[model samples]
Target chain A: MTELEKYIHGYFGVPTDDLAKIVTFFKPVSLKKGEYFLKAGQLSDRLGFVQSGIVREYVEANDKEVTKWISTKGYFVVDLASFVFHQPARWNFQAFTDAELYVIDQKNYQRIGQMVDRWHELEKLFIAKCFTVLEERVLTHLSMTAEERYQQLFAFNKELFNQVPLQYLASMLGMTPETLSRLRKKSF
Target chain B: MTELEKYIHGYFGVPTDDLAKIVTFFKPVSLKKGEYFLKAGQLSDRLGFVQSGIVREYVEANDKEVTKWISTKGYFVVDLASFVFHQPARWNFQAFTDAELYVIDQKNYQRIGQMVDRWHELEKLFIAKCFTVLEERVLTHLSMTAEERYQQLFAFNKELFNQVPLQYLASMLGMTPETLSRLRKKSF
Candidate 1:
């Protein structure tokens, strides 16, 4: 099975026929490090599922990029608002490393929405996951100190953090790179 | 149709039968201004859809309450992580007004998941809304000053700001009540 097929099976245990139908909607794309999967101001209609490497969603703030999320292998990466609303994106999606991703267009997404009886279940699951993450971040921002958030991040996604850069991670954690470096020393 | 029925139909637009099924799952709840909807450490199996008045999701940080999100009639409110994972809540949900709510238990939520195909689209729309709010908050935090965030809040949800308490609004804006009060004075 392909990597994308494996991911679907692992999550949904979808039958082969269903998986093939899903795959027909996808177009594979290659991205290089420093190249964007999707750029800000562009119309975003494709949802990219990472087969390999990492991607980050970021928005520029006074020339500094604030990283909002990091999408690793087997994860979906898209400016969801832009994709669903058919608008120009305020966010930028860039690869952190040379990567392969499967792109699904809006038409195909709606097609899948029509075909699968269990699609809603999967969609609900996806929304539930998004809510969980956003809630966690809100709590972290409100209640936890920067150091505490860093510790929590390590505890929550230690594996993913091991591959992410200090700068991008610092942005997501809502700390300066200098502060992150200082915390790193104190942590040791 | 009742106000509650009207609100649900406006948000989800389900058929009468499906709406009735959803209505059957909900239990009516009322709370005074000072009362809580759900406390920290409670299982958030019940998802509350606001029918009247205001509610806030909050957490205590250094003995001070930090508000996260505010829900009014026509909005959905829950400690989403707790609800999705079937775990105890880390945040407190409280009423800022004499509020009316309709709640659904997890079992019924799962039942709705099975029974309604459009329910998945509702879930997706709900999650997309959450992401949009989160994205906005993150952007406000990164790109704007505290005063700017406070200003943006009005621009984003003018009616909500009018209904919610200033302190809670300040909390959601990630500013001190004193700071927000001062900003409000400067605005006029």
Candidate 2:
């Protein structure tokens, strides 16, 4: 199975027939480094799954960019609230490197229910997983010390340390780059 | 239809048969003021719909209580992540006033699938609504000023100003009670 397919199975565990039906909607797409998949003020009409490369979600704040998240392979990259609810997009979703994505447009997304009765069930589980992940992220930010966040991130995705800018990671962790560096040195 | 039934219809608009089936699992329960529905570190085994009165979700932080959310009549009250994923709950769910609730345990919640195929679809929409609400809250906290947060809360739920303690609301809004009080005086 493809990485995207594997990730979907692992996360959603849809039946074989449903998985086949779902994968047909995802169209192949590519992005050059720094090109935005979705920009602020636009309605997000599509959601993409990262097959390869890096992408970042960020907002302009106090004359600086606040990174909301950075995604690599096996992640869905979208201004999810905007895509799901038809709201004006809040974050700019830009490729941090040349990237390959499998994207589903809004029209096809809506048409899924027409194809399968279990679509809602699968989709509900999909959205519930998203909610759970966000809940964990919110909990971590609220309850964990900055150093603990740094340690947790480092342990989970050590490749990000070299591949992505330190400042973006720091901002996403709700801390300064200097603090992350200090923690890194102490750990080393 | 009862208030909880009305809320379920307003929010999900499930078919009459499915709605009736869904409601059967929810047993009526009540709590006096200061009674806990669920506390931190416990597994959240059930979800409750508020028929009347108020509920608060909070966590102990820095030797103080930090209010995460307050739910009134028409709201579903649970540590959502814990309820969905079987994780240890991080928030304490308690009554802010004497409350009447309609609750469904995990077993009954799982039984919905066997009862209706469309339950997942309706449930997915229900969860997506929860995610959208959380997204809005996160955006407000990240982008809005403390005074703006207080003003918005007061404007939306002015009754909460009297019904709930200012400190709880203040913490929920990510502010100090003093700041909330100052904003209230300025607005008055």
Candidate 3:
């Protein structure tokens, strides 16, 4: 199986060759560190597959930015509202590290939806994955104390903690870096 | 189209015939006010589609019950984590009014996913719809003030607001009924 097929299987566990045809419409592009894959008010033309490096998604509210999601290699990131609605995005996507992305536009996405028998299954798998992650996040914020959240973050993905900036990581954890620092020190 | 097919089509926008097959797999059930369709720590055996009446889903946090969602007529109500994972539910689903629900068990649900072509389309549509709604809820709770979220809830579904209890609605809005009342008075 190709890299594309491997990713698809990782998502859906479907190995039909017809699935490979769905990947043909995607175009690959590189994003520099600090560059945006998508910004507020611009349509997110595609859902991006990360081949390497890190990225973050954020939304501006009440004159402050709230980090919503962070991604590294073998992950997908996009302003879902814009991609699905074909409207201007309210969120922004930025590369925290130089990144390689394979992107599929809305038209081709819908084409694959219509033509591929397994596409809906794959879509369900993708949605389920997103929901599972989001649910875990909500639980963490709702139930855990801030310090506990920070410690869990440090334990689960030390690479993410090292690669992403502290402010952004703190934002994603729904805490301040000073608080994060205290917790990290408490841990050691 | 049958009554059941009509309701299914309204949620999924799929063909009536496809919905008819789906309807055959569902059992219609009714519950009186104050009754529970599901409870915490029980295995959620079925998913319910509300034809009429009200249901509220809540989880116990900090020894206080927090309502996560309120489903009225034409809404789907289930403990998704429990139903999907075959585990004990973390949430409670209780009827706020006499409720008519269409129910489907896990076996039929898996069958629908594997066998029906249009069912696949409908499933994707349903997942996408759920994702959009959940995403909006997360954003609204995170960004909007409690008063703003309450106002938006009433604007979106005044019928639900009128029928659901004040305490439940307040929980969903992340405020006390007294606070919601103050906001309402301030708005007028």
Candidate 4:
């Protein structure tokens, strides 16, 4: 099975027939490095699951860009608020490297419910997982020291340090780039 | 109809029969001022919808108590991660005032699926709403200044200033109590 199929099957636990049908809606799409998948203020009508490379989600605030997340292989990317609520997007999602993704638009996303008998259950679980991940980030940000945050991220995804710009990782960890550099030197 | 009933009807949009059946599982419960609904390290087995009064969700981190939220009437209170994933609770949920709630235990929460055909759909929307709210909080914290955060919260819930300890509000907004005090004097 493809990584996307494996992820869908593992996470959602859909029966083979249902899983096959669900996967059909997602078409393969490519992006050049620095190309935007979605931009701020536009409605996010589609969602992407990264097949390869990285996508960065960031927002411009007070003339500074704050990195919200970096989506890598096997991770889904979207401005969830805009995708779910039809709000203008607040974050810009751009490819950090030439990338491939399994893309699904809103219409097909809705059609999955009609196609799969347990779509609602699967979708609910999917969103709950997202919520849980976000809650963890909030708790870490509120409670952890900058060095602790750097250490935790290093332990979790050390490759991220090499792949993304240090400044983006610093912003995502809610620290200045200089602070992240200091921690990196100490850890290394 | 009670406030809890109205909330269930409005947020979930279950049909009358299903709504009545769903509401049956939630029993009325009360907490005295300073009483705890759930405490850190315990598993959160119950979820409560506040009918009146305030409940604070806070964590002790780095020897300091960080208030995550202060839920009031019509709001739901639970360590959502613990409640959903059966993890040890990280936050203490205590009544800031004598409070009444409509609560459902985990068992009853699970049984709602068998009782209501559209339970999955409603539950998905419920979680999606929670995710969106948290996303907003994360954005505000990342993008807004301490003063801006103070102004936003004050505008949204003016009564909270008089109702709870200023320190708790300060902690929740991620500002020091002294900073909050200074901002209050300026705003007033």
Candidate 5:
């Protein structure tokens, strides 16, 4: 099975025949390091699942870039509002490293219903997963201290510290680089 | 048409026949003020659409309750993570006032597919709307000042200021009651 198939099965466990049909909607694509899958102000046209490498999502606020997330393999990346509503994108999606992705265009995404009988159930399950992830983020931000947030992310992906810029992680964690540096030292 | 039907039509624009079929899944339910729709640590077994009145969602932390949101008329209420994933609910949902609601248990919610062939499309549109709303909230929290958030909410629903306790609003806005008070005074 392809990595994309593996991800879909692991994430949603769609039946094998249905999985075979669903996989056809996605087309493989790649980006060099620092290239963008999407930029702010453009309408999002596709949703990409990361097969390898890193993608950074961020937004500009008062002349400063605020990192929303740095997604690695086994993640889907898109400015969801833009993709669904056809609104101008608010977040920039860029490759932090040379990345391989499986992309589904807007047209094919809309065609999922025609291809499968239980597509709504699948879509609801997919979206519910997204909502749960967002809910957890909100909970963590509201309940956890900055130190706890930093520690949780570090524990989840230690490689992020070595591979990506600390400033980006700091912004994503809603802390300053100085505070993150202090926490890093304290952890040691 | 009832307020709930009007909302479903206005929001999703599902066909007349499909709308009738979809509405069957929801059964009318009412709650007295201060009654919980779902409590923390319980499984969220149903999703509710409010026809009227207010519902407050909150979480307990360090012996303090932090308000997450105050849902008013024409809004859907649930612990989203629990409803979708069958996970333990993270927030407690309670009626802040005598509330008229239309609720769909998970079994009925999942049964929509057998009722309508296009149910997936309608459901996807519905979920995409939820995701976009969540995205907007995240953007507002990250980008807007606390005072700006207060002003925005006040402008959108001034009645909430008088009907709900200020401390719950303060918690939802991620500010101390003292800070919220200061901002309110400054605004006036």
Candidate 6:
């Protein structure tokens, strides 16, 4: 099975025959490093699941870019509000490195319901999972000190420290780059 | 139609018969002022839709209480993560006033899917709406200044300023009580 198929199967637990049908709706797409999958102000008509490499989602606020997330292999990338509600996108999603993705457009995404008996249940679970992840992030921001945030991120994805830019990571953690540098040194 | 039924009909756009079926699952419940709907460390087995008065969702962080939300009539109240995942609750949901709610336990919530053909679609939209609201909150917290946050909240729900405690509003806006006080003075 492809990585995208594995991820969908693992996350949704669709039967193999049904999973195969769902997988066909997603087409393989690639992005060169620094290329955008979607830009701010555009409607996010498609959702992409990363098969390899990293994608960064960020928004410009107060003339500075704030990183919202760094999605890597096996993670899905989309401006969810735009994708679901047809709103103008608020975040720009760009390839941090050359990336491969399995993408399903909005039309195809909706069509899955007709083909799969339990698609609504699976889709609800998928959205709920996304909501839970977001809630955890909000809790961390509200409760954690800058140092604690840095330590938690480090423990969760140490590889990101080496692979992604420090400023982006700092922004994602809601800390100044200088503070992140200080935390890194203190940790060592 | 009851307020809860109206809210369900408006939110989900379910047919009259189907809406009636959905409404039957939620029983009327009331809490006296200062009583808790749910507390930290308990599983959130039920979700409530506020019919009257207010409910507060807050968590103690580093010995300080951080207010996550002040839910009013026409709003749903639950530690969503705990309710959805069967995890121990993180926030304490207490009645900010003598509140009436239409509540559905997990078992009944699950049964709605079997009873209503389009229940899953309606449910997905409900969760998606929740996620979008959360995304907007995260964006404001990350991007807006304290004054800007206060101003936005005031414009959105001016009545809350008089109805809820200042300290709770301060915490909810991610500012100290002093900062909130200063902003209130400045606004006048």
Question: Per-candidate DockQ versus the true complex?
Answer: 0.50, 0.41, 0.34, 0.59, 0.55, 0.63
lDDT of 1 by residue, A1-188 (tens): 77888787666656778887888888999999979989999989888999888999998887888988888888888888888768798889999999899999888888987887677667667667776777667766766778998898888888876798888898888888898889889988
Docking class of 3: acceptable
* Candidate 5 structure quality by residue, lDDT tens digits, B1-188: 65677888888877777787788779989999999999999999999999888999999987778888899898889887788778899899999999999999999987876677666667777888787777667656556778998898889889999999898898887788999999999988
| lDDT tens digits by residue: candidate 3, B14-84 | 66566777889989999999899999999988989888888888888878787877887777877776777
lDDT for A14 (candidate 6): 87
Cα lDDT for residue B89, model 3?
86
TM accuracy, model 3 = 0.82
Candidate 6 deviant stretches above 4 angstroms: none
Cα interface RMSD of each candidate: 2.0, 2.7, 2.9, 1.8, 1.8, 1.5
Q: Tens digit of lDDT per residue, candidate 4, span A1-188? A: 77888998987889887878889899999999999999999999998999999999999988999888899998888887788789998889999999999999999999998889878888788888888788777777666778998889989998998999999998888778998999889987
TM-score of chain A of each: 0.89, 0.94, 0.92, 0.97, 0.95, 0.97
Please provide TM-scores, in order, for all candidate models, with all chains considered together. 0.84, 0.84, 0.82, 0.93, 0.92, 0.95
Q: Residue-wise lDDT of candidate 2 within B88-127, one digit each (tens)?
A: 9888999989999999999999998788766777788789
**Clashing residue pairs found in predicted model 3:** none
By TM-score, rank the candidates, best first. Answer: 6, 4, 5, 2, 1, 3
- Candidate 2, position B156, lDDT: 94
- Candidate 1 runs further than 4 Å off: A10-27, A154-165, B15-27, B61-64, B106-117, B155-165, B185-188
| lDDT by candidate, in order shown | 0.82, 0.83, 0.78, 0.88, 0.85, 0.89
lDDT for position B162 in model 2: 91
The true-structure Cα RMSD of candidate 3 reads 3.6
Best by lDDT: 6
Worst 10 residues of 5 chain A by lDDT: A135-144
Question: Worst ten-residue run, lDDT, model 6 chain A?
Answer: A136-145
What value does the lDDT take at residue B74 in candidate 1?
79
Any runs in candidate 3 off by more than 4 Å, and if so which? A1-5, A16-27, A107-117, A139-155, A174-188, B1-4, B82-88, B110-116, B158-162, B175-188
Best by TM-score: 6
Candidate 3 structure quality by residue, lDDT tens digits, A84-161: 657798788899889988888888888987787667767766775677566556556445677887888888989887
Distance from true location, Cα of B142 in model 4, Å:
1.9
lDDT of 4 at A141: 62
lDDT of 6 by residue, B12-110 (tens): 878888888888899999999999999999999999999999999999988988888899989998877788778899889999999998899999998
Which is better, 2 or 5, measured by lDDT?
5
